[model samples]
Target: MTSAQNIVVFEHDKHYFTEEQKRLKLDEVLENYYGDYSPFFKLIRNGVKFNQYVGVLKVGNTTIEVLPKADGNDKDTWRQLLIDMIKTVWGFEIKVSSSADLKLKSNSILDLYFELYTKELEYLLHRGLIKRYNKKEGNLYALKGALQFSKHLSQNLVHHERFYVKYSNYDVNHKIHCILYKALKLINKTNNKPDLNSRIGALLLNFPEMGDIKITESTFDNIVYDRKNHHYEKALQIARLLLLNYYPDVSQGRNNVLALMFDMNRLWEQFVYVVLKRELRVTDFKVKSQVSKEFWRSEAGTKSRMKPDIVLESRNNTIVLDTKWKNLYDNGPSSEDLRQMYAYHHYYKATKTALIYPGEEGKMIKGKYSPIEGNANASDNTCGIAFISTHTDIVIWKKNIISFIKENFFHVIEEG
Candidate 1:
């Protein structure tokens, strides 16, 4: 017997309300007319029943009912529905408002829903309903439906040798589609419970197949064919499957050797970047090799060029940072890596030179000679040569980098 109403009030008046006021009003309406945020259904003595669907909201005498076209139980379905609503409301509001309208209200209802969804998902993942598996270590965890999609894709890549042979002449798109189709079939047969590592292996196996496949008319046709008729959706679907389902748990103290190698370089680079940006006020920094080619020469020989992972340049200082993914405490810097970074520092005339490596070891400024016992000998100190070690984890590395930059680079700048 409850009816929904659409009431269009003066946009100016609604826009005038503060965020706090709007929130208070929304809470009041929900408490009085609509059921609170909970999953339940209740029947009253009168012909009125309270539905615990969080999508429904009430304001004054009007009830805003968002009808979800897809299965609400499916997480993806709910996500897509919320996204569609947000886009619709945003487009409508933009179209209705004049260019002169300064007080246009932007709603965070969709963001709130997403936040709630994320919290629940995180809880589920932590509680072990949805588990993460490592592709490199060959760890298999049971996940059903879309959660297992990535695992299946990976397995198809590694196990299917004939897939490469079959799609030899096909374009990249076609080859990828062929692999995806095979993988999906394999996954579907298992009723969603499949080995995550095997799926990742499958995807990797197909990469070599598509390496030589040209992107041409055949490729476009293949994409259309696969998207419209095949079991899998898109190339990104394959990627998502790997990222979501088979994301190797790197938190186990780098137990997976492959994961350590895979994540180390990326984490090291990010750490150096964060540090340089925060400390030196050097926002314009780039990664890997390409600087002013005209100004620099290769350090290895007459032919081989040396490339630093991070290059930060400001008006006052130029910093050349070389990030080694290896654990400095264990491996230390090889003569080749040190030579490469030294070449970069010397060639670039970088005011500061950092050989950044992965570990929790403290900063080591180049003394008269090497100080860490059997550690690699320090080449010089005037160029501000330093060895900075940080944790391998991306989050910890980021924090360390920022702190290092603030203390070293920023302090120097401020002092100067």
Candidate 2:
């Protein structure tokens, strides 16, 4: 794929994973990713549909493959899938080139990510350079530093506050710096450094040294980015999201698979959110992705959180929809799936809720199910079903989902 060394690219269709690759085992994958006892394991164990995007899997102790799941010469199909999945899964946008020369090994997803992340990080370091006066503290009794003036006197038995003023390293700029630093370090650990590696290497001197602020989701929260200092928000978001590609506690010398892997379930949930958001009409309904906070079973100290993939809210009603990137064969929807949708429906106080799964076939399929059937008492058509094929175009897929909503869902609110 594109003459790139140490990189393998494949389509997002027709799993070509060898028998040995299929048998590849990772204890952390099942535990941290697919849940310790998740029913989704049926697919992972079978080597069927594990994740949504064309991704990487740790085949051996050191081998990693850039997987493209959508098979065929249709690079557009796979590229569109990657774009859609990335936007939804990671809250960032990537500028894509549809030209013939697929600059970062057209098929290598990881390489493309590195190229995009490095480019944006470099730009921000150059154009969005903002620094503010900051105060630093240390335990020096010398008069050389800005003296604390007897402050923290008894607390500083061995250490007094030696304050100094300089540029603040705790700003968002430093957050971007650390993300790039850690990402570069991980790339070297996983495989040979690609062409983009050198580009990132060049930008090292421009960024401030972030001492020990660990990068996590909270790093981007409540961050102020207005007209004055808003120039680098895009780069900061890209850098932060790229750093998340790795599993948090990936072992130093173990297989890099865990390090470069993303959860398919999580990816599909977000992918569906992106597609639906684009297709829906903003005037009638506002759509939100990963709607766990608006409704929950318990919100106290007990630690129980329920997050649905997409929530569509309108003046008429609020509908909660869950997306499952599973192949719903003859078995149809499972009981656990039904129970989850029921909870969303009850808590949201909405008459309409749904379970959406990839049809996994040639054509689109839709079903309206009262999953909790036979219990006539609860059989008010509270839950519906939808199936969108992986191959459908955005325009057509949106129409299908919206039509499903109109035909099956809107009636509930209208009648009430």
Candidate 3:
């Protein structure tokens, strides 16, 4: 629709609004719909007639439709790029789905997830391998059990990778089956999708049902991925990811939308850390994430901490860098970010410090990644530091990060 009322905006593109109607809607998202996504919308500046940034922002009832960045041969969609970063950076922030299956009918993240989840389960079904894990439980209803108690415990006895028996609460397949059940319940409560809900609900019953499983770190701690346990792990992960996206029933409200949103800030940090690990692949250089520097000691002991996003340490030198997902514009980084970076340099005795942000070429003054940009807050007032950028291109962006480290910090020495 070419009508002003029906206009849709996409992530990472500029939208110039000549009408006050659209600006009001953008502000509504900023004020009202800003749930856990406050930081993301902050990246979208509400200018006089233009609001622009990366990522989707829903206005009223519709999710902002992102304009295609390229036409032909650039089939790498935004979701693919997003998933690529997620896989490389966190490695565990995904479920099973092919590239074709990841494309969305709508701009909504929730819609995309439901599609992926549905497809993944379907794939598992077609392969005939969406099996459950066998776990033993006690029962007295069936006298043929593992062990019968002194008569009070009727259901506290049973045993193996058993099948076709009564639902075992301890079984992982049963646990995962229950997770899907619980997620389906949550999804039903929302007005997000009705037909899809019906489809998922009907399909869910096809699998075995069990009592709700309390998912915890310990729930999966003992699990080891092997040939036998692979299917269960994949399904369990899908269930776990879905389970994490909702709040407890007590916290739910009338206006709050049950949407699953991931923080891109942490994603960017992890992405940089992963890429830098590649650049510093030499034997001498060691790259660590969240390397803590304890600068304060009290009765509590080592309470104050300086944990930068990345720490690159050689035998002689240490360099610290922090990743900011924000677009710094002409103003560069905030003073608070600089202050933290300065503290890192002071406490860790870091030879270099950098505030790395998402890069759009020609947007800001490109500075050398080297330490030649003298730190204003240096202990000696002479150490080197600079602001760096991580490009948006998937292939080149990673290489850019790797090269940025190699060219700026890594020192080569010739042996005798």
Which ranges of candidate 3 are over 4 A from the true structure?
1-83, 92-108, 119-142, 146-173, 184-206, 213-235, 247-256, 278-280, 300-302, 362-392, 412-416
Per-residue error at 27 for model 1, in Å? 63
Provide backbone clash counts, one per model: 17, 10, 9
Q: Write the candidate numbers in order of decreasing lDDT.
A: 2, 3, 1
TM-score of 1: 0.35
Compared with the true structure, what per-residue lDDT tens digits does model 2 show for residues 1-416?
11222324442332334544434444443344445443322234443343333455432242334343433335546555665466445544434311222255444455556665666666666565665434566544444445554554644655534432222233444444555566555554443446655666566555555555676677777466776556566656655655554554355434333335455666667666765676656556678887665443455645567777788787778888887766566787889988788777677765678787765433434444454556665655466667654553644645665665566656655554
Q: Which stretches of candidate 1 lie over 4 Å from their true place?
A: 1-267, 270-303, 329-332, 367-394, 412-416
TM-score of each: 0.35, 0.63, 0.61
lDDT of 1 at 60: 30
Q: Regarding lDDT, does 1 or 2 come out ahead?
A: 2
Give the RMSD in angstroms, all C-alphas superposed, for model 1.
23.1
The model with the greatest TM-score is 2
Score each candidate by Cα lDDT. 0.38, 0.55, 0.53
Q: How much lDDT does candidate 2 score?
A: 0.55
The list of candidate 2 runs beyond 4 A from truth reads 1-54, 57-80, 91-105, 137-145, 148-194, 205-229, 241-258, 290-307, 343-346, 360-378, 392-416
